[model samples]
Target chain A: MMTAQIKEFPGVGLRESDFEQRKVLYTEWVPNARYAWDAGVAIGRYLAELKEGRLIGVRCRHCRRTVIPPRVFCEWCFRPMDEWVPLPDTGTVNTFSLCYVTWDMRRLTEPEIPAVIDIDGTHPPVGILHLLGEVEPQAVQIGMRVQAVWKPPEERTGSILDIRYFRPVREG
Target chain B: MTRKVAIVGIGYTGCRPLTAEVSYKELVYEAAVKAYEDAGLDPRRDVDSFVTVAEDFIEGTSIFDEYTPDQLGGMLKPNVTIPGEGIHGLATAYLQIASGLVDVVVVEAHSKASNVLTLPHITAYAMDPVYNRPLQANPIFIAGMEMNRYMWATGATQEQCAQVVVKNKRCALYNPTAAYGANLEIDDVLAAEMVAYPLGRQEISPHADGAVVLVLAAGEVAESLTDLPIWIRGIGWCNDAPSLETRGWGRAIYAEGAGKMAYQMAGIRNPMEEIDFAELDDTYAYKELQHLEALGFCQFGEAGILTAEGVTEPGGALPVNVSGGNLGCGHLLDAAGLRAVVEVVLQLRGEAGSHQLPDVETGLAFGWRGLPSTSGAVVILSN
Candidate 1:
């Protein structure tokens, strides 16, 4: 038997009424539905580009910086990104993680390896985060060169999945 | 040596899983008003500086700093907003007072998560767009991965992780303001809906709506205002590698580093024996265990077994999260850290009511910024 010293302090004990009040108050404040219109359009555009087998990023005219995951404005320069540049799919892996569990905690028979790729052909090391396919998790190394694998044109959506995963490229 | 700072007054709005009766601004004002009254000072005249903690992504607004002053009664005060946890904001306030730059500082943090339409989508924005977001993997999945890694590294079991939720929620049953309090069995937690593999909904903290405010003053100022002033004995905060993949997911290196820094400053070597109680961040059940190891409460991976053995429960060895923690109380983002401080102050002052621990001469409060972001703060408070 563990005898831990217990001290008494003054205040009301947890009241059933308090819990009931809090539960009701919390449920009532929850927003039932929320939608982002711009995000939807952005996804549609990205999916369309993916189907075309071209990797595009939004470039800021003022800062001349390209964002791989294209955005309307350059976060750094606070300027609208109007130029769409097709970026070379080859890049080096900056970091990666292997996920052995599913979103809902069901153990996966096969794990997925995701990597942050610093794609070539862009200033300031334009990077994109995506799946690392055709490579063993143990073999994948930081700074290893990889190339993007595009899905067939018919199945391409301008979304990120358009390029299935980045595969290791053999250097000449 | 720096001038000591003390918490002269602390006030919190009743916490609920959600609050629809008031807007975010109104919620902040209610707590700020209570804190001002408790300090026996008028916010408009006495407060020399004001600090608020909020995140643009969480609040679903850009330039969130612009909207804080109107509600906090800082119409023309030196107010700055921090884009992190409330403890970071409090630490900033402590520095300002120690520098003799401010005499009295008010720190406020609140969350209105219930106002957001889609929390998952909002959280998805935090993911790396090129790879991680493409998978539509929920943020909680990262926690799952980390929990799995922690267990593998430390040889802890799922049962131990589930026990954390069981312990915290049960402790919360003694806290009147805890939102998720209930009589729960460990099996109940294990059987709850799994949001991510190895992680269940019960393992995660419910989103909550509430605000917490604290009035900080220099030692002399505090002595003049209040009979009992909880001294800020030590404060430490640090950030680890931002790339989640590059860092070890199982252990909290940042928290361990921060805790050590704080303990050193507070002259504490044996934390388990020196500290009376603690309020650790339990955003996820595994987080509490991970932090316990990091905070040196027990050996690595021993938290699971210790928790299963009822070591963290009230009346157990070094009671933890007596205010129910984020799991039972609710996750209020920036306010979560301040809530820990508030609980510690309450316990130390013997004002915690039903949830107070044994003679709390020294209390520690810890906060974690959560996944994909590695920031933590450790504050040691004493009466």
Candidate 2:
């Protein structure tokens, strides 16, 4: 038999105040982790098109799957994807979350609706994550039709946010 | 055929919410000492190689593995670091021993999750710097979004997800190492402060601080160290596409692929029958159900129903996460998976007093490298 078998969890627990009371030296690190990730061949053109107020995707010759935020190579097919295709800014919500917190656990006064929008002309489940705007939080539902609300060309910086949040499309 | 590998010894330090008294180095030393003692071997003499799992950003240190040798008694030995999950480290150890170049291997994984001042900020860096990081939403929002898709596709409910918390935490009450064990009810989980819609604060696992070390040896080497060795029947790990946009949202395809490989290796034609129990990745409560479905323990949507019907309780038919899952035990970043292995080891050895189940021969430990990574691994063990 293994000796000194752990019958109880052997770790010392401390309260938040214990550090202050014990005068523990806590060091804070502010890391400047900056990187200019090359959007590469696929995303470079994709971002360029986004700045031009358009959406784009790539078609894989093997799987025939349309990849958005396009990649130079098809992940499933593991082959080069040279076909660039234009896509509509309109799409449907594949999934969404009404987040009440920010990246640093800070509370928000109003919940942010982060969603994965299935853009038109792409595979059903393949979508980019973006926020939803101009729709009631309660009114948001999965599969609701929406269109991207783009920023003015002057304010665009070839970033994903060039097309701001998506809004629910009203039926005529 | 590949040679066999067995986990002859195991030792763990914690699944505690905080471990401020000791530095992460001391925690690693304590765990390594216990593991060596349990295996009845000297690390410098008997162990051939060492593997530790860590990430530069998560540890608050660059080249973090450089500082590992002194504490593990691994000075001047072959030591490697994997920046993936605990099971990945273990798999590497298994591979080294199976190659016959090494007789025994040590695998270590730990988390001082409480050390990082801005954990969410560090986690944000893991997101796709191009598409996802710019969103700046809480990373737990990903869990909420998946939970929504899972529920929408499978008919799982908020209440059913809450029951997972209820069961896992209640199971934790009997587990000594589990930090967040509670007598939680479905309402308590449901009523807990909502952080992400369709997901409450209680549903998300709070981080814990701890280290786990396991000594694995090949056939004869294993028997020489311990009479009762938990044999590694099979191991499998897989990942989805690098980008979240390209993968299926509702299904744990990684788990499915990993399970298929592991089950095939173990000759498990029917997972629901051949496997005795599982300690799955319940990083979020819904993940337990999702992983269970992916592992073929039940149909896609039936796991939530099983949880609701008491089919997954400790004494129930499929008894999942008897060590309280992550919900009850508190998660340990990359080390969470190896902690689950310890629970299964104790149970197989009939050393899990109070929470031990009877007549159990085979068990499984599945782990996920949570958030912004869809990597998962599965290991099946038998007594």
Candidate 3:
């Protein structure tokens, strides 16, 4: 038998009755922690290219890995990414999720098929997460070919949303 | 020369869906008082320093460290705050004791998850603003995609993942502090509302509020404080990648790295045979299987099979989450890891009344900083 023992375990749980009846004193306040994040050199150029309906990745000399949604420094090599590489807008669905709920846990009438798409010109598995369309939810499979469907050129806002979503690439 | 460390005392306030009677501070204070009394030490006289685990965003307050000292008897003392899991805080306390700068260090971690009305939006803030955040989706989508990739890579079925929920929640029926214990079936999980593909509302751990405080002392001090000091055999923590674009989708690289580090320290070559049981982080059900593989308890894809065979049951060869994991006992944000520690300490000391296992020796506890973070920590403990 264990020699030591706890005499009392103290933790008061709030019952639903008490909470609903306003039995507990409470104060609510919100703190604003907003920021205009600096996109730096690589991401700055990447977002700029997105406005023109294209994709770019930064290539590291040391690691020989082209990182998309580019960064100036290679996280693995601890060196600057010195080269810019152009990437295709098409890729495969590495993985996907059909979300029936919104960001705040609200139910949605239509499900959102979010997928990590392996853009054709970038390295394997280094993919962007975007919604999938032009297919049934059950039809979406891992390794399925997909092509980015961009928003109209005038609708481009230098954001990831510039590419509306990814659609299955039908073979000829 | 470095000294050995031991967990001298432990105290916790809950595993409840909501701790409304007391504020988060009162919750910590109560737990701290219990811990100090258990160790037979006074905060001002015997304690040397303090370490707390919390996140500014989760707490809905900036510089949360400054708000904690009043509750943990840490005012005017050397207090340190880590915005990670509770085991990470424990690791910090271990360093202080091992450094010989402090003979007794107190560590605290808590979760007031119910207080946050905007959890998803706040969690969305963790996404890569310029690249990922522009999509304006909830962070839960990341977990859904990961689960899909893990299942694809490991051949583990969704039904197998549901078994974990059944096992853990059923186990929670016997635990006093657990909140969400239930006799659930895999079909119930499958038939539940789907939040994301292959991830259901039933499979995800719901939030809870709790507080845990631990007392740590090294070598002679540990020997003087408690007769049943649970010795810390090894500790490890690691991070893989912060970006969703760069991380490995199929495996938990961070857990694998952390397990290797802790095993090397504890001289454990075969974790499957050496460690008696584990309380791994299961914020998501698939994570339990993924971590089991990463921790060397089983080969990749073998965890689901082993779990199906009852190998991880309390009566089986290697019990896992017998105290009811976060799935069974509600998820306690930053404090969840410490709650797992409380279970480990109880089992190691033979004080776990209804949940105690026989002839147990070495035990393991693991914690992961959930969502958009690959950081994980592992600690090995023994009687």
Candidate 4:
């Protein structure tokens, strides 16, 4: 039995007051870095189409998978994608969550419903991560049909946020 | 049978919610010194190369590699930083030794997670900027969604997930290095405040500050260094599509792919029988079941049933995470994988003391870089 000497764990748990005092003696810096992120060739076209109230995906003939959030190359085949395929604005909810917290770990009074909406026309099971609106948290279910609620044409931007959210598409 | 790599020595700081007494550099130095001393070799002379694992965004320092080498005694020697997780560093060291390029290598990984005030936001930034990051929702929801899908697909109830919290935390009680170990009932886990639907506060591993340093040597070098070196049998890592749009909601393709590669390399045909035990990523409670299935421990839905039947307990058949995993030991981020490796090595050496298991010969350690991405690494070890 090789029992090593167990030393008292050398970590300290401090309160906000202790942290504040320590910060007073040292210089603190806040990062405000910004990025211009070029949308690149594939996503550049995808976002441009989103601004025009359309959803499109790139097609790879080799793998025969139509992928959303389009990329220039087929991740599976490692070949340049050739054709663009327009997809339906409506889709099914693959999965969802009722979140009571924000990205910064702050509590929210109302829960945010984030979900993966599987687009209707894509060959593969391609689902985009986005928010769900106009539906009760308890009402959300996997395979539930939904449609994109786009921002008015005049206010649309070349971004994912161009479509505000996905809402339950009423059954006819 | 060209060459064999073995873990000659291992050292790590205790897991804690905060390490305010020392800077991150000092933490690395502490572990490095202990590991070198344990191996009976001076890193300044014996270590041919070095690898450190860290993610820049979490550290608030861009290109954090610049600050690593000096602390590990790799000053001007061949040292490189891996921007992924710890198991990846171990794999890199394993490759270096097997390639006949280095006789001995040092692998270091650490996390000063307490220093990051906006961890969730920082992690959310890892999402696709054009499609996912704009949602501004808490990243835990990703786990929530996955858990929901997993439950629906595998019949794994939330109660079963809570049971995992109970089991791992209870196991942690015997581990002196486990900081978040606790005694609680499954009901307690269920009653904890919900962070995201189906995922409660207790179900998520709290972040901790810690570091792990390991020394690896090839063949005779290992034989000369330590009488009880743990041999590396195999290693593998893989990633699913980096986009949320294409990833499977109910399965862990990454773990399956990585585990298959490693199993093939190790010549392992029946993992559940041949491998003595395992330490897998339990950063999220439900992930234990998910990874178990992905690693081929059982069929797609059988892991939840096995957990309910006590098949994964320390004394049970095919023991898993006997070291309490990330759930009880606290999540060490990039260092998390090494924590599992450290536990596996100690158990294999019969040096885990109170937590030691009898007659264990081989073990597996697996790690995932954690969400918004689906990358994983696996390493097999034997005594």
Taking chain B only, the TM-score of every model is 0.97, 0.99, 0.99, 0.99
lDDT winner between candidates 1 and 2: 2
Global Cα RMSD, each model: 21.5, 25.7, 25.9, 25.5
Q: Which 10-residue span in candidate 2 chain B carries the lowest summed lDDT?
A: B20-29
lDDT of 3: 0.87
Question: What is candidate 4's lDDT per residue for B276-350, written digit by digit as tens?
Answer: 999999999999999999999999998889998899999899888899999999999999999999999999999
Misplaced by over 4 Å in model 1 are A1-172
Q: What would the per-residue lDDT of candidate 3 be over residues A40-75, giving only the tens digit for each residue?
A: 455578888999999998788777787687765454
Docking class of 3: incorrect
lDDT of 4 by residue, A8-103 (tens): 546775678876788433433344333223344666788899999999998889887988978655545434578999998999999998999999
- lDDT (Cα, tens digit) per residue for candidate 3, span B1-383: 77899998988886888766666766777788789888888786788999999988887668988887767777678998988889999999999999888889999999888777777877777777667876878889888999999999989999989999999999999999999999998899889899988899888999888889999998899898888999999999999988898998889999999999999999999998999999999999999999999999989999999998999989988999998899999999888889999899989999889989999999999999898889999899999
Error of 1 at B137 (Å): 1.4
Give the per-residue lDDT of model 2 (tens digit) for B1-383: 67799999898996988776666766777788889889998886788889999988887668988977766778788999989989999999999988877989999999888877777887777777667766777788888888999999999988889999999999999999899999977888889898888889999998998999999999998888788999999899999996868978899999999999898988998998998989999999999999999999999989888889999998899999999999899999999999999998988999989999999999999999998778999999999
- What are the Cα lDDT values of the candidates? 0.82, 0.87, 0.87, 0.88
What DockQ would you assign to candidate 2? 0.01
Candidate 3 contains a number of clashing pairs equal to 0
